[model samples]
Target chain A: TLLENPEGLKMGGERRKITILTSDLRGFTALSERLPPEEVVKILNFYLGYMADTITAYQGTIDEFMGDGILVLFGAPTVREDDPRRAIACAIAMQQAMTPVNEKMEEWGLPLLEMGIGINTGEVVVGNIGSEKRTKYGIVGSQVNLTYRIEGYTIGGQILVSETTLQAAGDEIKINGQKEVSPKGVKKPITIYDIGGIGGEYNLFLETNEEEFVVLPEPLP
Target chain B: TLLENPEGLKMGGERRKITILTSDLRGFTALSERLPPEEVVKILNFYLGYMADTITAYQGTIDEFMGDGILVLFGAPTVREDDPRRAIACAIAMQQAMTPVNEKMEEWGLPLLEMGIGINTGEVVVGNIGSEKRTKYGIVGSQVNLTYRIEGYTIGGQILVSETTLQAAGDEIKINGQKEVSPKGVKKPITIYDIGGIGGEYNLFLETNEEEFVVLPEPLP
Candidate 1:
């Protein structure tokens, strides 16, 4: 029984809209290929576990992990009136938290890693789902897609966010406006911005490795 | 830049686990052949709008909407300790909700719509994806693949889920333990179950639609 019910379409009382942040690891394929499967799994566990912990530390929910990545949602399951601000804060914390994580990866003699994060805010339909057999809780909307688009813009070690997110985040976040680019399926070109750093002191533009490139994108086809 | 950075896998994080549901209109190809493009789009919109509305109400994220179907995720952008149960509950709701939706379609002289939903739950990597220029939020993994496999079992108005999901849903869900079926790429046969009606209202086995028949999967080469 996995079809829609009429009554269920009515919104659940008390649910509020919020911001979503979807983050993925950079260079994971190559890294996974470099290590054995077990090692790859181990490395992923170590890194992802740490990131989830950090995100949750800021009262964010680790919605789901899709392998080498995490879908982190703010002001959901638990709503914070300042969810936009909280999302920006979480992005900052995530960037800062990666330092020690990268250090550990280096210590393990594994290749150091980088990540890209995308954030968006909008009204989304949120609820529980699954069949008569299982159910899950999540959010849905073009906002989710927009968040993914922002993340897609991130190179390793960079945080990308949409203009809506930037406005919602307010002065709490430090961001440098990037270029406007069109994403597939979406008609309008979305402006991408770099999370310069968060909490004022932490800088996301730092390069941990000597050869880190400022831009991690491939040449256009 | 759009082809470079992917989310979640680059940095370490906890294992992101959740359920994925892939549902498509059954006999859509035949339906398409019989209908004009505009009418088809209209019908699809009506049907998908209903489905999408119900899915969002249940807290499930409508991750992507293709031509005639939607891919939904439970436990993303938000998660509960009881996500599996939530997913199953949502599935039941979906089936239960279909009655009135179909009635509306019939009123519009649109053919009754049927869907096949496959649900599977397990760990995956979720995150923001894309390259240096753009990014999007999404999920990836074998769990995602397995969920699609479960969807393949259904013909029309059927729900198929992996055993893992059943166990997770526990006593809340009632299933008719369909015989284990072999799916491609996996060594062991996946234990599947036919869904009975949800909330004790309907049973899948009792239904006898003259049009219903076993969906013959493509022959293996």
Candidate 2:
């Protein structure tokens, strides 16, 4: 059902404020190498099915699937005032959904898979992006690329958000930590926040904060 | 045109021995962050245009464009005996074409852009990848993911190939150096060859070879 939307195939493009989220399965390449092709597909399908369901439930659009990576967009063709909030919530849900997905993998004798998510909110050109014969609804802009760079910094099970998303998402979202990263191609170092969860149901694991409390012995008395 | 072919949209997929080439434009994100949206699109179009031309010239298919990255395939739709060689040769040509591309960027008062290419040869599932409403010809497998991991190790202007690709490409392709990288997901360390050029016309700059010459000084007595 994710790829069955007929309205997404219409021609032309437009510029709008949208939130883009990119998620990549960590260590999938190595895991797939050791397994049979059908098994790999089965495992990937099991993982991606949960992701797709969660994303669609939040009204997010599945732009495309890049093998073990996925590109998703919010606030395209349909816009909501809380698109950024929805994007963050959807990401949180996806992260939590991995529990059952991995459980299924365990039953199938497949290794557990981890995912890193990066979300950014900005203006982008969204529409059907190919020629007359074939085209798919997609969003493109520097923000999309930025989301990718931000995602590259994340490890397994971490959700990272750009400053713009943090600002727009309001104060309800908790921050586990923040990183000032100068990713390749950006002139300035942008601060990215590690999202802890929204509301009371989810728990926050501050993995990046361990180094901050490192205590050195009193100056070699 | 690259996106105009109707034959690439059929349903179902096939497993074939195709050469996958993944290239990413280095620092384009930082560069785009400093420029206007229109200007960023202009520069990207300029760079990707040259890459498309070279790939088409080599009879390769432009599978998909991942923002600043590209996933190309050879021996798809139609297979060729020299698909591996064509991939390597196309990579070399793409590296060579950067000079002109940089010149245009310089003329436009923009900084130079660098690209890293990774080529791999193996069996992958290639064919229409999505539902019938919207399907694109693409390749997916461990080899495809391995190509991405291999490309991750490359710097700007460098071409890295897997052992499989190097073996199938024959001796006409010159190697600058080789590295044993244990990329995540792979159980064992794999050797990746840094390709310098193809044929006698191109030069091989052994950037990876410099470290091998480290000489230990005489032990202090």
Candidate 3:
């Protein structure tokens, strides 16, 4: 039944500052090409499964999943002062959740997986979009693109966050390193920070002293 | 509040024969680059909104929407003998739906939109994926890849159906033209049919004598 006056959807959009999160498995695409499709999907299910719960726990709204990649929004349907912090916490938690996922994969004779998460905080047009009859929470901005670019820079098991997110997330986030890159479509060089952990109330950290994953990826355009 | 025994959750995947549909807008990506991202999303909402409702009305399970593209399943979580027929009818309905969507775009002073739909049928692994805590129905197979390849052959305003889908849908489907292309990764060249309409119970047809849209797209890989 279609409602003539769909109460939830308005034609226009609202501009608001929000945190964007994009995560993808490193080397998984090539790995998927080698394995059977079912096996590939099985690995993805386990990885995306744990990540979904972790993101929901931190109040992040999952926007969509493109194959093995996931895009999450921190403040679209609703806003929170700690949206950026929560996103950071969620990324850290997601990284930690990988241990159990990998363990399970090992038991099943599947390859261990590693994920890279990127976060950016910026103003975007956000709203209940996708026509009047459906409630598809949609957001769009250059920040969304930048988040994907930043994720592209990450190696396996790494979290690369934009400086804007760093500003919003505050000083609790522990940065191990930083890099400047001029991502495609961006005019100027921007700095992105590699984060190891966050402190204060939601204290969390990426596993330390782990062998570094150095697989460089072709940056996403 | 995680349920250890999620009633509908099954760890294993099920193999099933199903129909797959993928559709996308042509040249929209290049056109969108010139507009603001918010405007891009606004245009997408109207386009995807109608498509969503149309697909739902036909009992198609929307797998996901990647930007302006949508992947739908006709027989997953459940199946029917006439799934291929339903997919054909749904594709015809989706192509015809572009009329109203474009009209709204014109009223809003936005550029008109055109869509191409493709359908294919084959066996695949389908199941309630993600995790026991969440019911994310997922599918993966060579058929899924082949369906994408078939959709990649479509031009805007065209409906392309795979030979497999044609055979499954029976003779009620109307084929306007056919082409044999060896899409990348496929071992042998497969024939795809350009459909004009479907006969029988759910009668649907594309408008006759419409100006041919001549823009050729670089096939999706």
Candidate 4:
């Protein structure tokens, strides 16, 4: 479960650098309107089950499940040197996992689901929050909210990463496109990269500061 | 508490047409980053307390609190003929209440806070969600998500309302400006009205299918 409290973890919050990932289903509200409540639960269960498995597999911590959206943290309760790379790899795997999940949806005669994911690496206060009666082990920071805004800019099946994340992940992840966006409340425009894949033999493009791009073929003989 | 369930409310879900209001404190996450955890909690408590009081004063139900954001429902557990109008009035009151809140923040030597509110009226599935051990009396629907999207377009101290809300509010409220927005997942462009005040003397503009506008003076003297 996303709310699990690991043993020996401090109840007091700690500030740490972590990569936060937020993903939400596209058109889910519209889709849910047409289905019965029980059906909505089934779809959410199947979808979240697959996603939770993928996150755990990558050693990422599931933060909270907000209706059809999921907020996840990488490098919490424990830190990994390759957390950024792990986050990107985990995102790709989740995208790949969507295929089977969609296949099941088709069998059930339900509308196919698409997701938009946003990842950002930054410092956040993470640990138990709230009063004694009701406490939640979660993360809070501007980066957490930025991850949501970045996810907002995406459509179905798109994974967007902030410049900080791209720099941390290095050349291991390939990029399909890039854009600068000024999300509300943020002081300045941020450069975001549309992730393609992890070290794939795909065509890459080089762009000049003037916005001109040259396509470069990979694995050229 | 936003999650409080009043007496006699059903644990089972029900369908109802309620006005949903979502508001978020602009730039709060950035401001919190510079403050300590205890200070952050203090600010949230102060802000949310004022908001919760305003919502309850107007007979609205607080659904959930999302970090710096709050989702509220009016016409739930009971229906009111003037729920939409009450919601708009409540939003205006909240904006007005911000002045005192900001004053207090200034006295505390903290950054002043601004909020953006979005209201939408539509049918939603409401009642207990989750297992018996952990059920929440909340709302679910596309309209709930649309309210969030509408809130996204607002800056600080702005209240944006959907067409449904406008229709329900009728001539009881005055609007200062209007714009058409195509929120993500929404099929087409929607005309959103920027609310000015309730039953106030203000200039209003009328638009036609061709996007032609005619300005009319307040009270049509």
User: Which candidate ranks first by TM-score, i.e. highest?
Assistant: 3
Off by over 4 Å in 4: A1-15, A33-38, A56-59, A76-82, A125-141, A152-158, A169-221, B1-16, B33-38, B57-59, B76-82, B125-142, B152-155, B169-221
Q: Of 2 and 3, which scores higher on TM-score?
A: 3
Instruction: Report the Cα interface RMSD of each model, rounded to 1 decimal.
Output: 11.4, 9.7, 5.0, 9.2
Ten contiguous residues minimizing lDDT sum, candidate 1 chain B: B1-10
Which lDDT tens digits does candidate 2 get at residues B45-93? 5666677777888898888876567888989989999899888988988
DockQ of each: 0.06, 0.07, 0.18, 0.11
TM-score of chain A for each candidate?
0.82, 0.85, 0.88, 0.85
lDDT of 2 at B199: 75
Ranking by lDDT: 3, 4, 2, 1
Candidate 4 positional error at B61, Å: 3.5
Off by over 4 Å in 2: A1-18, A42-50, A75-80, A93-116, A122-164, A174-221, B1-17, B99-112, B123-135, B153-156, B176-196, B200-221
Candidate 3: fraction of native contacts reproduced: 0.18
For candidate 4, what is the TM-score? 0.68
* Model 1 per-residue lDDT at A83: 78
Instruction: Show the lowest summed lDDT stretch of 10 residues, model 3 chain A.
Output: A1-10
lDDT of 4 by residue, B107-141 (tens): 78888898999999998876554322234565678
Point out the worst 10-residue segment of candidate 3 chain B by lDDT. Answer: B1-10
- Cα lDDT tens digits, model 1, B11-109, are 332346788888877766456545554455445445665676677777898776544556788888688766766666677667655776688778778
For model 4, what is the error of residue B19's alpha carbon versus the real structure, in angstroms, after optimal superposition?
1.1
lDDT of 2 at B42: 55
State each model's C-alpha RMSD to the native: 13.7, 12.3, 9.0, 11.3
Worst 10-residue lDDT window, candidate 2 chain B: B1-10
Q: lDDT tens string, model 1, A1-221?
A: 12344334332322346788888778675455445545565565666666766786778887666657678778778887777777777777777778877877787788888888888887565455323333345554456766776788788777777777778765646665588989855778878787765554333343345446476689889
